[model samples]
Target chain A: MVSTYVTSSLILRILLVYLMVSRIAFAHDANEASAYTVQEIAEGNFVHEGNFPPQSLENRGDIANIGFIVGEKCVAVIDVGSSLHVGSMLKAAIQRVTRLPICAVIITHVHPDHLLGLNAFTKDDSITVYGHHRLPKQIRTRSRFYLESLEQYLGAGNTADHAIDPSLVTPVNGLLSIDLGNRVIELKSWDYAHTDHDLSVTDIKTGTFWAGDIVFSEHVPILDSNIRQYNAVLEELQKLDVQHYVVGHGSLDRPWDVLISEQRRYFRVLLREVRAAIVNDISLMDAVNTVGWTERDRWHNFDMYHRRNVTTSYTDLEWED
Target chain B: MNFVKRILTFIGASLLFCQLALATPFPEPDHSSIPEWIMIKQLMFGEREIRDGSDDILALYLNTKLDDSSTVPIMVNALMDQTEDKYIKTLYLVIDRNPIPTAGVFKFKPEAGRVKLETRLRFEKFSFIRAIVETNTGDLYMDQRWVQVAGGCSAPSGKNANDPSLGKMRFRMDDQIRLNEPNLVQFQIKHPNESTLASDLEPGYAARFIDKVAVEFNGKSIMSGDINFSLSDNPIFKFYFSPQAEGVLSVRAEDTHDTIFTDSVEIGTDKR
Candidate 1:
């Protein structure tokens, strides 16, 4: 009886050790509150196991981040990086992991830093790029001008044509998901808060949520047509139980609940004070004068942005009522 | 036996990985508890153009909201009392607002003309939009757009959002598309208007706000003002100026750290 018990116990220990080794291989370097991983890539789901080389025209510093995820069996590439170089580099990275075919590329949003690598994803079947309805429109409208600005900013190393036709566009509505073998990726859309159309992604395997532009990590949240709606959305993000949040511009974070919570509190406070200023008939000047303005110090050259935020918030408050 | 040990070890390893994957950047954020004084971080001064996408003149009217020690109506009275000017008409107070509650712009008709002056103001959250105009008769009309950003005074910079290096700051001037004499100029830049409640990515660190800006006309001071973080990045601003006065226009901005950015351009009177 003792030998039998020992034999079973030995087998259990071996199983435990094997699982431990696998887990150790994929450990995350950053400190997080929780952790998880993918089990397998299911069939029909696309896999981004190839590189979509960035166009020769993309400027450096213009590409923020790049990567792709799988849904069921097909794959979806997240970012193509700055230029043709980064895009190609990412494709190679994708090839290293999976052999599944890449079905489409989701721009996430319309910023050059995020979508300039469109050329890499275009394929014979005409790889579809998804974003908010306004996104493809924005890409077609501003590609040239933005290209000029990018060239001026990053110099010639990112030289290439910047025009992208809306023909390859696939606009996403409320929420969409990619089913990896044993994983699921959830993509959600928000108003023009960060930009004209911001799309976020979620990995169910690890519960790592990718917030393209909505959740900025250590970077600035670029503004667009609306700030009121933006603030409201930021407040709403708090309602999610996100574990890992990968912002469009910064590092990933665990316990996204905290990020959303803090952002919500901020907008609420801003609304109250601005409302008060209006009630007292503070001349836009006196209101500006009477109330002291602060915060945003460490941001390199934030003065220029401060003025814009004020205008956006004030307009939102006024129009809201 | 060895296989069993390996499986057990694998389970242990995976548990450890999970902990790191879900670690929160900042265990606790400073959502509340920020002092009122610490909220407002910067002061800014600039003129807002209140016009459709046309060259026609816009009349601006204004209201005020000073601390109880001094009411907006009282402040307006005091301002008029000091300016020795009477053309300033109308006053409205914004209310239910957490910060200051009174401030609005006065609208102007085609006849309200020839206006140029700088003034100081207050805000609750860093948000305040306005329209200003002057009539040929010295009648000043202004429109105030109240905002709901309560943390405006000290809203953290955008850099506090996620990636600071992704910082993209710019200074630009948009040329007048229509007429010359009363042309509208577009001024814009980008920066993270940080909120006071905003903590550094590592947590514990608080973001700062903006302070001052100097607008120069031909190397001379045209408009110098204070600012706050209530502003947004890549702030696009529009204002009306005496288009007839031809000179090299330069703008220099200074924030809390005393960081200075100077960009200049020549305003062409005949661009229209």
Candidate 2:
């Protein structure tokens, strides 16, 4: 009779423990629903591919791909997505895969699509944020404008509630290397290319190049820097012997050189036509609509950005010899 | 006589009703009639020959739908031949609904190649932007484009207005002045050209901008402009002038801050 009583208590305790453990598991599973589906592109490399859409309430600015690399000791996040919610999902994704501590969050540029979710990782003191040397100035100057745009597109409630504080950023002036156990990642800050403050990351083990916006896959290239300088950077990028490249936009399935050549063609057309327009004394008004228009069919979202690109390139190239 | 008077009254009433029923979405200018335009024309030209631009001698180009109110691009091309004897004497950019109707006044000499001028502007509201060209013979030809964009004069100045180079002036011209030919001269002044609407959002800040510009060739006024917030930040003006004699082409710009910036480009003779 005593043994029977102990057995009943034992079963009850086992059931209680099982209920508590499942509840905890269920909580994490719920978060995983919102979590990104990360694919292992290489050994210990995971990438979440996002849809190609403009920043709107429907998409909630989930229009840029973000991923992370796992080293033997820790992990490095390439980008944190576009909002605090997306960032939280990314963190959940990391937890689902491994329990390793996040060592660094590397921001490739100052674009909101890549940097707005930075606050998600800021709470963790172990994670150090890295950006280009010019990033702090850009963030200071442009953060307010970006926030205003974010509120307009994503609504006030959906915004990440993050403010750009330069003090928290560790600036990468030139080439710097970070060791994640057995893996070594090289970080390089580029000159006026995609933006004045653009950083690229390369994994020495897998030979994977994380080229922020420097290499766009399908999205129309935006020109915020000197077009001449951008072209020179593209030439320099072509010479690099990279095994695989992760671009800021478009499909990563295409070969790295193919994407580079395609981008180069767009830049070349813009330069040739804009210079010709300047020499022919065509006014900016006409040039904005007509210059480099032949490639309209080749690029996606060509109508949204091509004219502005022409305007930027024209204004910049007019001063060129 | 009584019958004729009754018919005239009926016609005038019908026309007024028709105008009110047009239902145009844009806000029409306060003074849109021929007589109203002539009143401003008389105020500006003072008994000059003003005629409708039926000949299409002057063309004004602007985007019908503009996204950026602060920096609007505008181009004016004068098709009339410009020679020493006769050329386009002046081009007046008139935005009917702006706080200042005269956006800019550009003077051109024969040496200005093709009589083409391009620059950026600011529009206060939805209205017609007229490019009135006056030839050397005192004949005025007008062409206009109805722009639907607004909020240019009163839009926020994205940059902080407290910068130190608020009224610095810069000039770009040919190193060698082509005498008796049209040489292009461009000048830019660094100022926020703040608008009252922009000031409304910032506490303890008042609107300020370059209010006047005087361009002189050899101390003779080529053109002078009275500007307001309708000009973009760091207001730029590009025009053509024939260097009559090698001297100085000086520009003096004054802002609401009571600061005057003066710059001059020496017109040296071109090497033969």
Candidate 3:
């Protein structure tokens, strides 16, 4: 009788311990799911402001501003974060706001930070991905390097399940409007400006413009494409009468015109100085060191990216007739 | 006591699992010694000793903190001027960790007056950029700068292959030319210099790049280089050429696709 009692009590103890441990694990996941907070900038339009620092393991690759819009029946997700973890958090954030199914995912560009989190939402068969028409080609060429970089940032295990499928993206050539029941979001793809391909979103109901990386506010503007073309695109963007706007990085407190002008001025200076350097018989190596020092204090992270801008400008404009 | 021990072991196991789930920290930049260099050195120079060139022979200049991996401007300057008796006959540009370790092998004529090479390169990873000089007496000296850049070889070439001005060349020089003195001239070719490692490149399509670059003054060779796609797109070179008299500075470049681009600028006596 004593042996039977002891055996029964031991089994009960083991069962209780297992239940407790599993429950704790479940609770931990729940906490992580709700960790990302979103602010409704406009009605039905939510934005999660990301960190200012570059992607790091500590940040879990949440370096870009990402959010989604809820309509009457479904939701449209804008640029997803950099990793699966970030995407899952955004998904959970959406669930916390509404139970609507995500019908569309709009990618702003082919950059890794905005494109890698796509797989997290892709698991659901209902979501149709949208990006620039040129995005698919860029993805095909750059995805391998981006994945390797992700592994470097988030480690092998954290990134093992991450994969970028270019075929999943629906190419947006010029102007495409997506209807989410009562709300409609217009996606416009621009010519080579910030990148070879860049897409911007506009919420028709709210009149809020998601400028993507085309209009950087506080962060130093990165010139990956033609400077003259980029400046011309900015001139066109300035004409849009936006009631509300979200930049790719930095707070959106400044006036839209001021933001556009500041970015335009940076590129203008780069174009002028680089051209002068080429004309004055200055070597490309020497020009990078001295070309863009005047705008150093005007923008953040200028030291890290300005020399590169000079290099690009010198190489491109050197070919000008 | 047995139950307590079991619970402890379970907690310990959970902690271990959690540790595994977390991200691994990034590796520190290690510049102590590169294993790739050991093997590359053996193949390029069989049992040949290399002396440090930073002190007197030549110096390599490059920014250690690279922003763009695809286009990095670098310069190599010879500390001593080129002389007929003891001049740097050949210069080797080597990137230790690239797919092709030898980026270029440039031959310099002593008549050039001085040896200076300025060009842009693509770095595949964090590796050393070495400027190796071989004197006429067969002595080798090397200067290296460690550069931190990645994915340059696979980075998509921004140049459109179907550009209308493809294979065009341009030459720039000072307004005035001096007789019997080293004058700087820069020449650039408009080519993609496409790398095979670029992922989007179609399989079975060979990557096209400049293989031979020859510069001459009045039909006499001054600088000739055997190069590869390690040179950035639209390869530009700046070097010194001594002008004994008025002559045409001509450049003929041949690519892997069997296309030849040639351009020349006349050095006028009016400037002299």
Index of the highest-DockQ prediction: 3
Each candidate's B-chain TM-score, in sequence, is 0.44, 0.72, 0.88
Instruction: Fill in the DockQ of model 1.
Output: 0.04
Give all candidates' CA lDDT scores: 0.47, 0.77, 0.86
Model 1: residue A263 alpha-carbon error in angstroms = 2.3
Give me the runs in candidate 2 sitting further than 4 Å from their true place: A1-35, A156-160, B1-60, B65-71, B76-117, B121-213, B225-235, B240-272
lDDT for model 2, on a 0 to 1 scale? 0.77
The worst-scoring run of ten residues by lDDT in candidate 2 chain A lies at: A151-160
**Residues B1-272 of candidate 1: C-alpha lDDT, one tens digit per residue:** 46656766786676555444333222322312234312321111124222221133332333422221111111111122112233322222222222332232322122112232322233433233344334334443434433322332322222223444222333333444332343444354444444343333335554544445556565655344445443433333333344336677676665555556567777664553
Error of 3 at B102 (Å): 0.6
Residue range A58-135, candidate 1, lDDT tens digits: 122433545677555667777665555446555655665578777768777766667676776675373557777766
Of the two candidates 1 and 3, the one with more favorable TM-score, higher being better, is: 3
Candidate 3 lDDT by residue in tens digits, A1-321: 999999999899988877777777899788766667888888888998887647754466787888998999899999988888888888889988999899999999988778788888999999999999989888888888888887765543556567778888999998999999899889999998888899999999999999889998889998888888888999999999888888778877789999999998898889999999988878777788899799999988888788888887788898888
Interface RMSD of 1: 18.0
* Candidate 3 Cα outliers beyond 4 Å, as residue runs: A1-31, A158-160, B1-33
Candidate 2 positional error at B60, Å? 6.0
lDDT of 1 at B46: 23
